[model samples]
Target: MKVVKIGGSVFKKENIINLAEFIVKNYEPYKTIIVVSALGRSPYPYSTDELINLFVEFKQNHSNGNNYLLDLSKSFVVSCGENIAAGLLSFAINYLNPEFKAIPLNAFQANIITTDNPIDSDIITIEIDNILRLLENKFTPVICGFQGVSKSGKLTILKRGGTDITAAFITKLMKANEIHIIKDVDGLKSAPPNIIPHCITIEKCNIDELAEATMNGNPVVNPEAINILQETNAKIIIKSIFSEKFTLSSKEIVPTQLVSNISNKDNITKFVIYLPSQMKNKTLVLDKVLKEIFENSISLDFINLDVFNNLASFIVNNNQVEKIKQILDNNQLHYKTMGRLSKVSIIGYNMRGKPGIMYRINKALLNEKISIIQAQDSHISISLLVPLKYLATTIKALHQEFFEDY
Candidate 1:
């Protein structure tokens, strides 16, 4: 069985029909299970600030339209999940050229249980077991992507791009042949194209490399879903939904050798605040300070408190240092010391298991007078911490070393 995940960005009505046609015309020989996401039905969900504003708007004007709008936001999430399944099913039989029979799968009665709060959820097993039985019967199952019904009988939405989790879960439960995720983009890129215009596409990526790339902030598949795929040994492929054709079975989809020089540099600003760790109502003071910082749109980088040593340290955006200093001075806050920091992460698949990569990188940074505060390596990337002032020099040196030719 081939399990396919269609992303929300490609979830338009016309696109859904085209995808169905492509699948039937190309890959129908293999039994396929499809997973769909909610991003298709609405604009991306609100961010932390936007959600707060949405709530505030509701409070200011308590009207039926506002209430309906809020409820619709919730409903759109559920609908996106359901319609992806329903839309695919409807298109597969009625619209596609060489149409195949599609069996619409609903979580309502099936044990597909989830949590009430859409933010965090836990699934029940009995429900999963029942769903697996249907797939085992040679029936094509269309499952919703983001929303789930919890054990407590509450509706819950998965994290952003969470359809990947649904796909991985189904693969483990049904033991499908492989999972294919089709999105608008052809495949994962070395970096976000917007930031790095010269970024190249990756032909093949390993699970560990994929996860590390995501953790360092490029959106591919969610890192959590990658873990599940690794655990179950499920073969996975990510491709474009807008493609003209699809392969008939897992064997037809091949993995190729592909690598590209990539660089992603985080723009950093930092501020440091140091204070005695102990004082009466210290916790309350810190809370108020953090609230003010956040309210001013100043994001924190890292914070450490040493009670025994009677010291506290806060690191934030470098550009916000002046403002933060003014706030502290106005409040008559005294501190022992403060400083700024910056970080740069290098991401690539071929970077692992090699000696001296870190050594060479560090030496280059030192040659440029960029002092390293801390450094760490992962399967796909190296994260280096340094003074904010030298962030440009650090990125330029590293890029020259690894990507100058490209």
Candidate 2:
């Protein structure tokens, strides 16, 4: 079985017909499942965003200011977009190919069970047997993406851009051979095309790199989709739906048992908070500090809390140190600061039991005369803090040593 998720950007009528024809021509030999998003942006009244906005306006004008009712109404209203898309696409596919039976399925019809959040529900389970029965009967299932049924039988929607999550979950549940996410772009690029003049399309990437890229603001796919892919054996392919020369040779995310990628994080400041041994109410003080950190919108890059030793160390961007210090001083806590550091990491899932990997990294940096201030390693990554001036050199040496081929 193969799962293909058609994105909202290509949700035009002509595009839907084209997609239907394309599926019949290309996927005739396999059991195929199609998932479709709501229609494309503006000019399409049934687009997800437009539908949500329409609900918001209606609630403001007519609702009694009840939060729960508003949320429920929003879910019901927003889900109509996907329902329409599924119905239209199913009809198109059936019209284009009478021999192949195509049927539209909503969250309730498809038996997609999710949390009762109404607006941003997470899938709890899906009725795999029902879908299998449809396949057994030679019925092509056109599932409405981004919608689900709550345990209480209420309509719910996954958050925005959730069609990817739907596709990923269905692929995993069906144990499909692969998942293809049809988009408007050619494929994933090394960097944003407009930002990097020479950015090239990456034909292949692993889940770790794709997740990292997504976190660093690369718009490839949903991060939740990548998270799901990480736990499953399913491969994800990104392709262009608009290209006439579209082929299966687009960007692919295959399973990599272990892979490494380089990450450069600059403008870091490390803090060491010293406390008396057996300090009373340590938890309370720590909670207060954490509350202040969050209230100020400071993001911690690294943190280590040693309650037994009466020490707490954390790393944040240099710009946030002054505000953090003010909070600590106001609370009469003693701390020291190491200002202006950069964190470079070799991120991989295979570094845990791999002997000498850390040694090679340390040796390479030493050879470059780059002193490491602090080093931290998890099963997934090895991170080092160095002087800001040495960051570029450290990244170069490490990238050359570990990820040259990548």
Candidate 3:
């Protein structure tokens, strides 16, 4: 059996029928399961974001504090995108290739059981009985992606880009022979191609390496889904929707390059807290600040500490800028902010014990007239914080030094 996941970008009028043809022609031999995402960008009535606009307008006049009714309603509407796609694809397949039957299955019929969270859900279990029965009957099951039902029978939705999770879960539990994720791009690249045109396609990589390398911002694979598949033997094959070439995920991966990929997170707000030199117990005070941030549930990244200078700093998404200020002000902690910042990161396991990588990074940025604001590293990754204006130049410079030769 083969499980193929079609991305939302391939759902436009220009290509959908072609996609159906490709699926039918390429996957006709296998007992297949097709998972579908919401239609592409908005203005189209059935697109996921447009569906959410329905709830957003309703919530404006009938505002209620966070509650199940509001969340449940939003989940139902957004989940409709996948539902529509599933039905449409099933119909398309049946029309295009009459000999091969394609059946659409909703969350209940597909038995996608998830936790009680309505807006952002996690899959708890998948009963293969129904999907298996369909395959045995010479039918292909087109299951709605990014949605499941809670034990209480409430409609629930997964995080955005979660269709990847749905495909992996089905393939793993169903013990299917292959999992193919269809995207419009040419496999995975070291960086966003638009930003760094010279970026090379990554032919193969370990799941952990990909996740660490992408920690700056890319999220090439759904993190939770990657975690679920990390222990399994299944290989995730990412291919362009209409092409045969692909990037494969492997388990026993060895480092292939000094640096495998580079990615950047833009519009980051960095907060730096410096303790008074005369203040006693500086370590204790720094600990308190960190504890408060954690208790308040403010997620941060790229943390740096200078014990001798009694300074600590970290970056958070721009959306949380206000929350950070509130926490700092209420706690009476003095701090400074670097707004409109970006963090460029290089990720690779082969970098450990290697010399000149950091020197090369600094030289590259210096030559491009890009100043590094702050820097941090782990065994496999190096994150350099710089002004947002210099982001493009930083990525290009680093890519040239590390990947152009590679």
Top of the candidates by TM-score: 3
Angstrom error at residue 269, model 3 = 1.1
Off by over 4 Å in 2: 42-44, 243-284, 287-406
**Candidate 2's C-alpha lDDT?**
0.77
What lDDT tens digits, residue by residue, belong to model 2 across residues 148-187? 9899999989977788888889988998877888887766
Pick the winner on lDDT between candidates 1 and 2.
Answer: 2
- For model 3, the stretches where C-alpha displacement exceeds 4 angstroms are 28-30, 62-66, 278-285
Q: What is the C-alpha RMSD of each candidate to the true structure, in Å?
A: 7.2, 6.4, 2.3
Candidate 2 has a TM-score of 0.69
Report the Cα lDDT for residue 98, model 2.
75
Residue-level lDDT of model 1, residues 1-406, one tens digit each, is 6778877667665455676766676565327777776434334342222343555576568655665445435544444445545555545644554334466665554455665554545444325665556656645566776556666655565666567787777777777777887877666665556645554566656665566655555566766777777766666677785643332212222334322323333544433345555566666666777777778878654366554465456555446777777677765577543455555677655666757778878888878977777566666677766776776667667765765554
Deviation of model 1 at 164, angstroms: 1.6
Question: Tens digit of lDDT per residue, candidate 3, span 334-380?
Answer: 99998999888898878888888888899999898887888888888
Order of quality (TM-score): 3, 2, 1
lDDT of all predictions: 0.60, 0.77, 0.82
Per-prediction TM-score = 0.67, 0.69, 0.92
